[model samples]
Target chain A: MLERVDKAKKQIHNTVDALGRSVNIMEVCGTHTVAIFRSGIRSALPESVKLLSGPGCPVCVTDQGYIDTVMDLAAREDCLIATYGDMIRVPGKNGSLETMNRSNVHVVLSSDDAVQLACAHPDKTVVFVAVGFETTTPATAVAVMTAEKMDLSNFCILSAHKLVVPAMQALLSDTKNKIDAFLCPGHVSVIIGSDAYRPVVEQFSRPCVVAGFEPVQVMEGIAEICRQLADESPQVKSLYSAVVTAQGNTRAWELIEAYFEPYDGPWRGLGCIPNGTLRLKRQYKRFDALVRFGIEEIPKEEPNGCLCGQVLCGLINPPQCGLFDAVCTPDTPVGPCMVSSEGACSAWYKYGRRGKVHHD
Target chain B: MCLAVPARIVELMDDRGVADAMGNRWSVRTTLLPDVQVGDIVLIHAGFAIATVDEEEARKTWELFAEIAEFQERQAPSSKEEGTV
Candidate 1:
């Protein structure tokens, strides 16, 4: 195993040395960002091949209005708010779930926990604050399926899931970040398939490598992209071939299709991308939070002078925003970027961004 | 961030499986793996089994982590080597 690590590290070093010019490699997965930082891989790489973070954090990309709506539901008397731990601290217009911790909102590690909460409290309405990319959507689907299967009307989902491919397209369109290649989100590819990125590769002429969350897998993915870029060949590749397939998991897709449909959703920093978000399908409208709670029009609200939107779209770096370190620390977060642990800004601030060369 | 981990299915309930990941009991939907059994190892993400994992591969990966820990232990100061995991 040590021999394998040595070989891979030597290969990486060789690749970095061979590619004399500066190469910008962007990892478009939040988990990858954490792994990269945790493994201290960035320090191992040469300054020539720079690795940058992208809009891969599900909770970070959730718009302010969506958080406000969830808060609105949390304030209700008959409602019990259920959500992933990451979304709990995200500040809405009034207060965050952390502030409402003593009030009603309950943070659960999994969506099944929310389903159990609904089952246990049949008298109360359990609003599972569903927020994630495709990786986390299946759990919400299972929860919805469970509610339907057991004929439990007490459970509902407030979905804020954003699709990966559309978001990737938006990133490519941006002029600020000239990403040479992309390390695509692994979990999304597990459901959508490695070939799901074929369109982006064909159209934008960028190499997309679908990789697992393992440190080795991530490094290998970067290596794969460098190999493609250095040779001037761009294509969709799978470094995590053990898990990800060309067509992906069919049944997971079926479950997702059965539950939700793509819709225009407002990303916290990326504005609204057409069909970039997932909403509960009409057939399961009874489980839809907006319809069931009759809370449709959430007045749009942006943070005061926060460039979370631009940060999310990769148009600007985190520190470029005046409010980043001074006004928007983790404890007193003003935007979703500062709130989510996987967020690029949160990653930068949490892990030292002192010497990072801010692009654009 | 793409956070995924390998887990062994402890129990199967229709399309759902109760899997254990790093000592955590996760109620995972295993619809992705049609042939997955109670003892089968699977890669899970967002409460769903995204792929069937090869136990041999998992053991190899764990062995790698264990090896790294051992090496790091040996590299630690003489007094701290005894305290290595």
Candidate 2:
């Protein structure tokens, strides 16, 4: 594995040297961010070539208002919050779900577990906290479908979902950050395919490489992007060809379409993007917490000194935040970026931010 | 923010399939792939089979994973000669 990574590193170096220009590529997946750091790939690269992390972490990009809203729901006695392990410790306006120490809020691995929770507790409203890119929405959809099928009326979902394309467009439109090309999320690409990213490449004329999570996969993707830049060709290519196709996963898209509709959604740092979020369709609105419980959207405020928004958008690194390390360690994370395991801030704090280990 | 993967369908129901991903088994719907069946590896996202994957590609990925394991094994220096070296 090290040998392959070494070769890939050499290839990336050679490609970047040949390009002879500063290529500031942004990886739009949290897993890629962690993997890149874990593999020590950042240290292996030429100083001229910089890899930035985009708004790929679902939790990090999720708005503060939504976190406060979710925390509000968690405070209810008749409600049970079921969520993936990542969101438990994320700080809300007042406090986090983990801080409350309420027995009702449970960490579940999948949406199916939430469905089972609703089934087991027929009296209580079992609300599954749904958050993720396309990879996680289907599980929540399945849970909803299962609830409807089994006539489990108490089951609902608080969707904190965001789409990839609009976020990409938002990044491109931002004057604060200059994203040369995009190393797209591999897992997300499997569902949406390389074609979903065609618009970005065509409109922005920036290279898009849908890449896998492994270190070598990222290095190969970087090499591909460098090759495209060197040749002045900006196109969408699937470095993880084994999983991603041109059209992406049609069945999953259909299922999501059946259960949810495109609506204006909130992003933590980017604010609201039209049709950038998925909400339960009217047919399944009964299973939507926002609609079922009449939880009006509240304008929530972020922490005073948190740079999580800019951090998520690749506009700034974690160290730029004033509260980093001192007040934003994983144990006492002040922002969602510090809370979620896949978050860029968390990854840097855990794996990357240490003694300078520069490599040739 | 999309995360999807290809998994082989191990069980088929009316419109859903039980698929496996990296040893994790999941109940996924086949609404996207109308003609999906057991033994077929399907691309899944958000708990639905989005498309029927090319088996050739899936096999090649498994082959690569195997090669990775083999390479890791070969790269490991023998413990017997470790101290001497």
Give the best candidate by lDDT: 2
Error in Å for residue A260 of model 1: 1.6
DockQ, 0 to 1 scale, candidate 1:
0.32
State the TM-score, rounded to 2 decimals, of chain A in model 1.
0.92
List the DockQ of the predictions in order.
Answer: 0.32, 0.20
Tens-place lDDT digits, model 2, residues A1-360:
678777767777787788788888999988788667766778778887877878888888888888888998988999999987778788887688878899999887667778889889988999899988887776677788888989899999999877899889878887887788999998788778899999898888999998876667888889888888888999999988777789887766777888988888888888787788889988888999999889997656679999998887777888778898988887788988888767888777876665453211
Worst 10 residues of 1 chain B by lDDT: B76-85
* Candidate 1, A1-360: lDDT as tens digits: 456555666776776678777778888887677567656677666667767777888877887888889888888889999877777877887788778765567877677889999999998899998888877787788889889999999999988888899988878887776788899987788778999999999989999998776677777787788888878899999987777789988887888898999988888667788799999998999999899988874536577898887776655678888998898987678887777767777766755463444344
* Pairs clashing within candidate 1: A30-B1, A31-B1, A31-B2, A269-A309
TM-score (all chains, Cα) for each model: 0.88, 0.85
Residue A275's lDDT within candidate 1 is 90
DockQ of 2: 0.20
